[model samples]
Target: MTGVLIPGPGKRVTLRDVALEAGVSIKTVSRVVNGEPAVNAATAVRVAGVVERLGYRPNELARSLKG
Candidate 1:
């Protein structure tokens, strides 16, 4: 699963990638990553697992721009 999700050595895993791998929407993956309480336990756990497996991370530059 990890091998399947990782783009390459230089490529960083994106949230959208996690969502696709987890079979959830981007918004749902975002909610989980942000540690929002809107997502249920089961979904959150599943998303978290995918996050870890894919080494997915929110882009700091993107976060800064959004902020």
Candidate 2:
């Protein structure tokens, strides 16, 4: 898959992009995206906003590998 973080015509946005845009660590973005407990609600909300704005989506293959 392409490494592009900004989704455009046929491009897939990534977690790293969300983190960078959200001004948080990648792990924090992961936690927020995965619905993991312990993330601050405010932070999660911020990350979610960035995700929506950036059109970010988790790579399913990488997600499965993480599990």
Candidate 3:
């Protein structure tokens, strides 16, 4: 059963990683991910690009808490 070890479901790209990749802060990533009005359009685009590249998925439970 030996094979290449793949990152299983337990592995996830967090907001911190997105922020780091986008050269922004965690709060900025959170704001962009949540579609907050405060985020600049350009910044949002940048964050979104990083999110897509990194395959970052926000946690639904955390999203609900913001509502």
Candidate 4:
């Protein structure tokens, strides 16, 4: 299942993991994942690569609640 791809005990790759792997802050990873402008191209690429490799799936409902 998709859950197996996630690094967590369940099916979720937390922002912290992506940040650690990408060598960036959680905020930066958030910006890249949320498609926010201002992130550098290289940084975005790195974050995206990590996301793809880790099969990270952002929780849209959580983001909407925060927004």
Candidate 5:
């Protein structure tokens, strides 16, 4: 369990969680996740690692709700 993140009982790891862990903005994480260009290469790599480590998944339902 070392170096692993455990979310709350019913909480899904979120973009904000990754951002917080990666020390980047939520938008930056979004760019990295969506393959958008222009993010700092090192920052993107860090964010990617946090995303994987935290098991972060964009909530499809939340995206649909935004539209």
Candidate 6:
């Protein structure tokens, strides 16, 4: 039997990618993903835009620990 070859890195979108796209830090991306308060409205919107564009989903296990 032959197996199929997957193209590119098979994995989920990471926080680092979101941060880079949003021009912010990983912590800012984390803040947006986790729905944390105190983040500036503008910054949150920018981060959210990046997250949506990249279809980035936070790692639940990691997010839980941060809270």
Q: What is the lDDT of residue 32 in candidate 3?
A: 90
What's each prediction's TM-score? 0.87, 0.76, 0.74, 0.78, 0.81, 0.72
Ranking by lDDT: 1, 5, 4, 2, 3, 6
Order candidates by TM-score, high to low. Answer: 1, 5, 4, 2, 3, 6
Model 3 pairs whose backbones collide: none
Leading candidate by TM-score: 1
Model 1, C-alpha of 53: deviation from truth (Å): 1.0
Q: What do the candidate models score in CA lDDT, each in turn? A: 0.86, 0.80, 0.80, 0.83, 0.84, 0.76
**Model 1 spans with C-alpha error above 4 angstroms:** 1-4
Residue-level lDDT of model 4, residues 1-67, one tens digit each, is 1222346576578898788888889999999998999899999998899888887888889978996
1-67 in candidate 6: lDDT tens per residue?
1121222467777888777777888998888887999799999998898788777876789858987
Off by over 4 Å in 2: 1-8
Error of 5 at 17 (Å): 0.7
For model 5, what is the C-alpha lDDT against the true structure? 0.84
| Candidate 3 runs further than 4 Å off | 1-9, 62-67
Provide the global lDDT of candidate 1 against the true structure.
Answer: 0.86
For model 6, the stretches where C-alpha displacement exceeds 4 angstroms are 1-9, 61-67
Clashing pairs in 6: none
- The candidate 2 region of ten consecutive residues with least summed lDDT is 1-10
Global fold similarity of model 3 (TM-score) = 0.74
lDDT of model 2, residue 5 = 53
Taking the tens digit of each residue's C-alpha lDDT, what string does model 3 give over 1-67?
1221333577988887777778888999989987898988999998898888778887889778987
